[model samples]
Target: MEAARLAPEDVLPASEGITPAWPGRSVAVDGANIHVRDTPGRSATVEPAVYVHGLGGSSLNWTDLAGLLADYLDGQAIDLPGFGRSDPARSYTVTAFADRVIRWIEHSDRGPVHLFGNSLGGAVAVCVAGTRPELLRSLTLVSPAMPFLDPRRSFHGRLLPLLLIPRADWLAARRLAAIDPADLARMVIESCFADPSRFPEQRFAEAVEEARLRYTVPEYTSAYVRTLRSLILSFVRAYLPGSASLWQVARRISTPTLVIGGQRDMLVDVRVAAQVARTIPDSRLLTLHDVGHVAQMEAPRMVARAVLGMLSEASSVKLVPRTGASERPKRARRNTKSKRDIPFGGGITPAGEAAG
Candidate 1:
């Protein structure tokens, strides 16, 4: 197997203007109203792709990436229950989140679609790929929030202790409520982006607006806090020697997968990126320097190029299996050199070559 490389044609032009968030509408799936921002493909023949954002992120997170991929994919970025304009869900567990995504795909009759996830969404995508292999054409994970014990970032370390307290979600919400929406948005941008200056002013304003709207939603802060707590619990379960660990789930996934990570990520350790690629049976990894947790947002064009490369390979080989099939789907040839480290502004290493 060869490493996935970005071709000259795959590089998005720098002159391409940033697209605003696609128009969103509510769709009911299993009694839950999911808000989805739809980006129509360049043609009806283009395949479908679904994007799921990380914890505390909404469908808007995929605005740029989805827009860039619209020529090849009809994309839908969904706001999970209790986020964006969606109603609160009864549960916030990772399994519950995966179930929602599965239901949405089934309800929309869009099986065997390209599934893309970031952070928490990546974990949810892992469950979906493992449990319902036939529902995905391929899986792309961006800095997935897999269970890691070492909280290198101060923010994560501070938040971990709060999970031990009773009614911590309420307490956290109360504290968050005291902060200004703009300040909160700024903090998020600072934490998520390796270079905060790269964030567009328009997007920053939209994030501020979203933060203010969140304050109006009664369940907003609680949803964020509880979801974080659930994710932390999942980390515990993943580390324990058990069949239910996320690593085990990754091992079971047969879909062609692309795992992208940020070398300078303040949250997830970059070394884990290689482990993720090695764990997934048919996977490739890309590590980008000078980027942080939200690589999809920080480097949409580069992300889009890698995604297109994967899609090209998947389509050329017709790797997607029929829905509801019992047999394991065909796997792509395993890449001997599964990981590639891309410099912030430099040439890429060729496929199957190790980057120094």
Candidate 2:
């Protein structure tokens, strides 16, 4: 039996209503309530894929890309504990989060999913893929928060370490409290994208609404701060050998992998994208010129196309070269004239030397 393929219109209807095609539900798995955005695929027998969002993000982050790729994959995007609608966990750590995902995969009886993650989730996905290779068919990471010692590349890179300070949560909450949800949304868009103007207004509005709603959650600030601290800690541990090392995890991963990075990302360094690609065996790196940290949000169709291509290709693993960027998907390059050479903030160009 073969899987049914989906078209973009099926998931991305032209309507302007709030829900659109992607809808989410809370599911109890392994004693944890996980918020998963559900999008039915073209066929029932098709294999399932799961998406994990970055720190402070929810399943909503995967909406556009998941919708765009729904034609080819029966997808679900998980909001890690303490994010979205999920209940808070006793402890928040990359390993703990990855364990929750692994347990869900095992409990759901969903074998070897096409795993997708961005930023912190990407780091968790790497841990999962490296530790339990049996649970994944393929892995896709969009700006995975791999280790980079230089803090100058991004504001978050510099800020992450400081989050370990005493009462960092209170400080962060105080900082966030002064900004309106809409303004916060704009700041996030500006920080995450090469060109904030490219973001869809409808989606932008939804994001603002979500931001407003998110503020109401009592655990929001604590979760954000704690997760940021844990993520920074993960970067520190990534240098060590054995299970603690993300590099070790990358090297141990046997599954085929696809890594995506943006040239103008203001969070994770773009150069880390290529470094991660080189670390994982049988993986390829795709660098989107003039794009930002959140490539899936910035260019959904393009990201979806890249994901679908990686999934559709033969299962055989191959070594992609470390030099130069992976070719941009043809569909993504159509409107080159509209894209500007956006400048990166917080001196994020050190990776540019590595990229060269």
Candidate 3:
């Protein structure tokens, strides 16, 4: 892959004190060695957590959230096949990654787990939940990829050419390499943050390091292109009659769910994440106004609170289906009332609840 990467001399760690902690083990998935980080001791709790990361991210990406998550449900984070230290695989797709995830679960102490996913992983978790609801207690999706109602809005959607066009992929990668790695990394970081100043310089440096490694690695360009292409393809065809967008699938999800979205995300619109919550009967949604893309990284404490909040709600919600007789016949027998608060103000619902 062609990469605009930074050299070791010109680029340095973002902060002097920051240390990216990576502690874990190795497992096998689809014949590829998978790296894992487990919270000590078997979880003597109700929830067994398994986290999945976004495109171009690995298990290490969840470093910030692990300790907080462990305080809730002692769990581990594992690298998906062909990412991180894991050996490159035959293919990278939702199904392929899901299969690997299922294998990991089977061999883990956390099968039938509560899953957490961000971006690309969020989509995978949703697909897996569709086929194996029994294996999942609930799902927590952070800014999952959704179908574009307006293709022109998202930067990634509009930048699709960087991956789709022939040879452009190579050219971009090469250009990326020639440019200062730290500078390119900053561009990416700044683009994602609501307030770029809030971005951790240390984390940005780590990103640069990762970029350099990815660029130097053979087939990295192809892998990056393929990953981006697959992401777009999945979003475009998320749902039909049989297979719908993951958001659509979320509506049918019987498992308790929490949908977290970044209000300022330039890539995946916040509106879609709200839709994901609305579609699911047992789901609650939280919109982080200042964070983008990777919320846990951007605001770890808030993300932790949200995750814990969802778990608390999930614990109280019984999985039993809601059943009731149709009230439409009786509704026609009674008079209906409606009121409007007027434009530039608010409105009252038919049920009399005021909405602003």
Candidate 4:
């Protein structure tokens, strides 16, 4: 028997008066909490931009990019359901993640704004575009984890499969906490950055601190476990050879898209970067050399450019690339003339380059 199919409207309920407007606060939706941070652009006409972080990551991951893009329009970022300062969701799935995003879209003061996501967040963005095209102006994905287990060119991510077991969570959680600061720091330096030398010491400290804080939470173990289970199940279902893959949804996405990845991404193979571009009819790819899994961290300007480009395209605006993208004004009134661009590329462009 087939699993189930959900309509766009069925998944996204109208969340009127449900989610509050908070620049850097938590909001409730569908009984689940999500962290939201909004920055108004310089212009009243430009639409708002929504940013989503990956698994175990919060809206904080997008802080640098969000601040720059928010300057482009009414800008924003989210913690998804479970990972950040906000409380975990009652249920979790790619569809559920999409639902939270859609409901937020329905509730926003800005209509059909630009949507940006990274890794897991990238997958959610794709699902939202496929499931509810009407709610999106464009899509910008940063090293989205849409590809299945590529036995070659990947290792640490193999850790995800072990997630099928509950015990693994305990061990992983324990290990995360018990590891020496120097060793943990080494992992961060190796896994997170293309140039470990450049990372600000305080910033890395905050990430480690946040990870430590999560380790102390009671639900942290279970939430991480269930989150892993969901991924394993989704992966199994999406990769049944003859069945649909995440790329299947990408193909049906009518919205314009920009897909990007880092040359040094170890978790999700950068090879899948072009898959999104090939599958999404109107998509592009930007692969930055010497970067890692966290594009927003390693290259915020590049991520911002892709998002702002897509937003401009969706709003039908003729944009001046590079520097102008940084100038997006705050939320005001919609201008009939131009919009922000949606640029998620599959190949490496400079930090903020636009393609034809």
Best by TM-score: 1
- lDDT over C-alpha atoms for residue 219 of model 1: 93
For candidate 3, the 10 contiguous residues with the lowest summed lDDT are 347-356
**Residue pairs in collision within model 2:** 6-71
Model 1, 1-356: lDDT tens per residue?
A: 23555634423433234466688999877676899999887544678899999888999999888876765788989998899899898899889999999998998897779999998899999999988999999999998888787775435767887888898878877887999999999988898888787777778878999889888998987788888888888888998998789989989999999888887777676666667788898887777777888988887767888887787776642222223322322223222221112234643334555122
What would the TM-scores of all predictions be? 0.88, 0.82, 0.77, 0.78
| lDDT string, candidate 2, 179-253, tens digits | 999999988888888888876666787789878977788778888888888777777887766577888878999
Among all candidates shown, the one with the greatest lDDT: 1
* Residues 144-248, model 3: lDDT tens digits: 875665766676766675765788658767876787767767776766665565555556666788666766666565556677777677666765554556656
Candidate 1, residue 132: how far the Cα is off, in Å = 0.4
Clashes of each: 0, 1, 15, 34
Candidate achieving higher lDDT, 1 or 3: 1
Q: Model 1: clashing residue pairs?
A: none
State candidate 2's TM-score: 0.82
lDDT of 1: 0.79
* Error at 266, model 2, angstroms: 1.0
